[model samples]
Target: MSTNTPTPGGPSLPQERRLVTAIPGPKSQELQARKTAAVASGVGTTLPVYITAAGGGVLVDVDGNSLIDLGSGIAVTTVGNSAPRVVQAVQDQVAAFTHTCFMVTPYAGYVEVAEALNRLTPGDHEKRTALFNSGAEAVENAVKIARTHTKKTGVVVFDHAYHGRTNLTMAMTAKSMPYKSGFGPFASDVYRAPLSYPFRDDQLDGATAAARAIDVIEKQVGADNLAALVIEPIQGEGGFIVPAAGFLPALQDWCTANNVVFIADEVQTGFARTGAMFAVDHDQVVPDIIVTAKGIAGGLPLSAVTGRTEMMDSAHVGGLGGTYGGNPLACAAALAVLETIEADGLVDRAAKIGSLMTSRLHALQERDSRLGDVRGRGAMIAVELVKAGTTEPDADLTKQVAAAAHQAGVVVLTCGTYGNVLRFLPPLSISDELLEDACNVLDDVFAATK
Candidate 1:
């Protein structure tokens, strides 16, 4: 419905949204049946559409539907799916060598990625980096390094935080239903503090919220025993809750005073996805350690924990690293991703995307009372759905709205601890026209649901 045209330099795929059949169509339904038989029930998909190809702002399903991509594969394809740079880098690296094990035989690509992360992450202090396979691995290793550096065992996390699904990260996470349901006997010495959820916290100021959380940490965990305080600059899975202005800086100050390492879990908010290279850049808060993944390697599975040189060096020789950690192919992809981000000015692009999304969503909110709160920054934005007359979360409405959007050929994702948040994470390379089209679809769906 949008008349705007695709911008130049995006992927070559047709930049449009089209639905030829019902939501899943017939082919996708058949594949869904096969998936049901072959895949475990534990693995669930947001949409049953079988995607055969994706590029620019569209996901081409097996059924021949060109669905506008707004999730970016959970914010992994910041440079866009199959980006030219990433594809070329991977192809060249694969031709040369797939894997020789970084632990056994080091490669220049790995070192290059580490050097890039060290130079890009917030703060100019001398830093070190350790590459891993995923965000969970990077987070676990960050904890290990923090403990080693501070000689303490306690780590403090925040409410509504979605760290990871690993044993250690599960303990660090706050949600229980899907992430930490059956798993039990989680790691010890982990603490949860309150976060600054402005909409739900009665509009508490950032400084007051920080004081309240710090009070709990000092009394319950004791700052003396705290080795690190880990938090997401803008939470990802627990809804895109951007903490108040002073919350992060105050927490960083507390960590510095207590000799506790401050860890920024920027896994879902890093690599120019949040307007800035990192979300901490928004508040000018420098974290002692920052964990990054998702958009780091342009869809490749590569994560890193970059931090102060001393903290990173505290770990003993070979205390970190795994068999496939920092695979050569992934490292090469990361290098190209970094280059693409810098050259294409994706940081500024993210800001423009944020402005477009926020302006559109805010306009919709003015008309729909059920749209509770519109929040987030850059390409990562979300709307909390609630009952029309009250603030009570309306998860059913959220589901209906998302289903309607998917049926109409828009790929949207729902998140948040309350299951009432609809999030949009479009690729930075998405055309303005395609983005407007997706929003138009969302507008219709929301109106119909109401």
Candidate 2:
């Protein structure tokens, strides 16, 4: 692992995982009780530790336990929680004025964010950007823009894709029990296609997978009626599934020929969470519309839809935007995030993090027959656990390992269509020593589970 120290600008933290009490200590238990009464049952939390402060790769809970943060709040705090630049910008902006409503009076911060996204996102083609409050909102707007531009109603998504949780986005998402259980009567014209899942797809190559998906799309939805093809360059909640090589490019080509707007949902993979600035950059496949959020604003709620200027301009002036589409404080945070990524060379840092994780995970895989696959890019990495000598998912064992890690003062997350994948998204600012320590804990957990 690289011997680099934590990034210089974040708040000073102990940089070590510490546990003064159990995983959910007394104070946290008290807070959990309060949450049970006040918060909705449907809003779930992976860990019930109530955090009071977070920075430099650790989350300090109300009970004074400093847990190693491997999830990065599900990839939102890529630059680390309470990054100095983001905190400073948000403070100054809040002092000046909280909200003027970009639709009403407008502000330079919003315009600057849009400008930065326009320059940063893929392709040299002219682009325009519109900001929103979340990944779901950005996706809804992307579909709206695609329909307006192409005059088509059908929208194509993948089998294991996870768009968001809004009504329209829920329809786009593939998981059923949680994301789409009782929520029914979904929006029409949304079609699902098979994804290029290499591990589960019988060693199918990129061309074959793309061809299979295209056959389904052409037969079911008809390209003439398709407005957009929305996909994550690196699938997130659906197990960090990276499409086979050449798969994304082929799909992009088909979309181009059919005049279907290809939208890349970079919410979880954007802003250096992956080794590249954006996941799509790995393949050099530029989408017509790119939706970004998650890590875009340090930790604030901000998302954007950036696309070709012609397609973006097709929407009517009053047709887009909401009350808090681009809140001034979020805009400020986003600007700071962009500057931090450039000034600190976080793109390279992400690559380093990925190397450390993949190397350790691969070594683990070599020792354990239950470890089926280790895949993903940069800071975003995952291990798929399976029954020994078979590809059958071992969800129960996955749960046991994660629980063990949590008890040992490490914060790990599990995700996948089959519920058997353990994902890690450590902050780019995290130190190699801390990451190595976390892996050591994981090593023990897996050994015990086996």
Candidate 3:
């Protein structure tokens, strides 16, 4: 792998944190002004810093600040931004041809990606894959395939779930104000069920939580009517909520018994994010349909729905496809991303990162009661903030801490249903020194938070 900027036109970025001026310096502020005037108000920026280049574990902003990247652009650049392999693959593919539209004239890259997904994804069952542009597209396709296979319309999603922003996915998502509020009337026949949120429901064990959710599904949407149960093994956007141990297995069993497709939305937790190739791997639970994206292509816009051969083929010949579903460039990047994961042993690296971050956060939790819970696996970790003595969320504190971290040249992110969870998703390329620096910054910010 060459040590070059993954993105063409950008210089090779160094892997360290360095603040030249402020968080959003003059240039970024000017860009923000332009964005306000030209872009839609609905589209928001988290840190308000315009990035120029990103590689390894830092984001180089237009202001020349090298911010320690703890967010990985919401877990998209798992193999690191401008990854050498991805860069070379994409560059090589682009030089050959940009697009012929796989539907019109198929390419080998598309079939290769499908074959890779079939092999990497959990289960030894014969599987088929269809590519898409984003996680939502993959998820929407998964639901379509499930309904077609089972011949049922009812779909179940869990509380605090965030599948996507599409009409169908927006209906499936639990959060309302931002993702749903005015987007309705959303797609119908979508129902919400309880999730095994260990932190919130400490009284209930994994089995109990699964039982509660199963009861809701059976009572409200009977097995005969249900087509699928879509879940994120470790919920992202809703919070890095790692469902209790037995919860996922129990649900998988139920889905199998009822013949409902169990779809694992691994968009955020897939591709060695949660110390494993996929989060469901932790529990050895095999979903009938698995949706993947984000980390799959080292920052490229690509997603896939891989499932049992029969269920995936249930859709008609012309039923599943899009114009730029599996672009050669994206396919090339994905192939490289997969190679990097295996060659570099990123799965173990993620575990190391998780252990280091979890330990640091756990130490912090001991000193600050407001840091209520430190949960998650691998590099995908989060700390839910509360009001010192109680479980009541402290969204304000979360915002303040994240802002402080950003100002201090560390790019962290905030998430969770109540908006009180500070999530961390640094690239596997990040060094122990960088991770320690991020932890030190968090320690200072948390101590300062009231």
What stretches of model 1 exceed 4 Å from their correct place?
2-9
Locate the minimum summed-lDDT window of 10 residues in model 1. 1-10
CA shift of 366, model 2, Å: 0.8
Error of 1 at 199 (Å): 0.3
Residues 341-373 of candidate 3 have per-residue lDDT tens digits of: 998889999999999999999999999999999
In model 2, the clashing pairs are none
After TM-score superposition, the amount by which residue 208's alpha carbon in candidate 2 deviates from its true location, in angstroms, is: 1.1
All models: lDDT?
0.93, 0.93, 0.92
Error of 1 at 226 (Å): 0.5
For all candidates, the clash counts are 0, 0, 1
Report how far residue 446 has shifted in candidate 2, in Å. 0.7
Descending-lDDT candidate ranking: 2, 1, 3
- Candidate 1's TM-score reads 0.99
Model 2 lDDT tens row, 393-442? 99999999999999998999999999999999999888888899899989
